[model samples]
Target: MIVTIAGAGHMARGIGNRTLAGGHTLRLYDRTRAKADELAASLGQAASGADVAAVDEGAVAGSDVVVLALPFPAGREVAAAWAGALEGKVVVDISNPVDFSTFDSLVVEPGTSAAEQIAAAAPGARVVKAFNTTFAGPLVTGEVAGRPLDVFVAGDDEAAKRTVSELVSSAGLRPLDVGPLRRARELEGFQFLHMASQERLGLNWSSGIAILP
Candidate 1:
């Protein structure tokens, strides 16, 4: 699969690592071209056999899947901007709408989530809520404490969900199909508590939330 990831931040690195490890071609884009180039080079070094490159925004339309690794607001803005380009693509939203200052509640209105807002912005895209519960640190290796990370997936389209699930599994993580896209509400809520508990639990953003069989 050809995967395009926006933003060259920590989450982008983590997800990019997994994407390359899954043997998929990766194209990276960021507002600052230099950042994207740097990330692309770094990922290429880590996975030498993988096909990867830093590309401009215009190249994003060619991707089979596009992962919006930006924050909630930026994700929504970009989704709106690229709504036409994202049509029929599996677009993954991995953001939690938490207010960083308070860290006690989400920024989005009640009864909705970042994934839902992003979906509405890009009506033609197949939006899926995933990776919000997984931190950047653990995502790089796709595991924690000798166990695979469980990626919670929610999407309205069955095939889109399967695509993401396959990618997650290919990267050596467990993909749990929680339900339809609306279930993003609970996933976002659950991740908020997980984020808040990090400091209290001394997890240092390294913990992984797992569901045992």
Candidate 2:
């Protein structure tokens, strides 16, 4: 599958590397063309990068999926910008809308979530929420304590969620279906608490969330 990721940050690069390793083509875009170019260069020919607006709609025009690996606000903005271009495409939202200043809460309004917001912004785009729980480092390396990482996915569309689940598994991670898009509130809220705990407890970015058997 061809996956176009809008953002060339650590999260974007990590996901792009995994997508490439999974035998999928990747097109990475960022506000800064140089950052995208640098990332594409590092990943070789299987991956290419460009400015978000410069990313030909053709690149994503026939892609199996497109990932919004951006921060919350940017993700929303990009989703809005690409809404018309992304019709009939599965859009994955891997963002947690946390209030960084508070370090313990989501920035989203009380009743909605980042995923839902993105979904609303691109109504024709099938938005699936996943990868918000896993940090960038673990996603790139594909292991934590020698075990494959676990990725939880949620979305209103079952097929879309399954597609993302397959992508997660192909990237060498365990995929757990965590219910519908409404559940994203929990996921983002959990991330807020986790980030706070990491800072308050000094646990470092190497930490991750996992379900116990």
Indicate which candidate wins on lDDT.
1
**Per-candidate TM vs. native?**
0.98, 0.92
Per-residue lDDT over 17-125 for candidate 2, one digit per residue giving the tens place of the 0 to 100 score = 7887776767877778777777887777444442222254456776788999999998999889889988888999999898888775788997789999999998899
Shift of residue 62 alpha carbon in model 1, Å: 1.3
Prediction 1 TM-score vs. true: 0.98
- The Cα local distance difference test for each model comes to 0.94, 0.83
Ten residues in sequence with the least summed lDDT for candidate 2 = 45-54
Q: Which stretches of candidate 1 lie over 4 Å from their true place?
A: none
Instruction: Kindly report the root-mean-square deviation of model 1 from the true structure over all alpha carbons.
Output: 0.7
Q: In angstroms, give how far residue 136 of model 1 lies from its true place.
A: 0.5
Cα displacement (Å) at residue 8, model 1 = 0.4
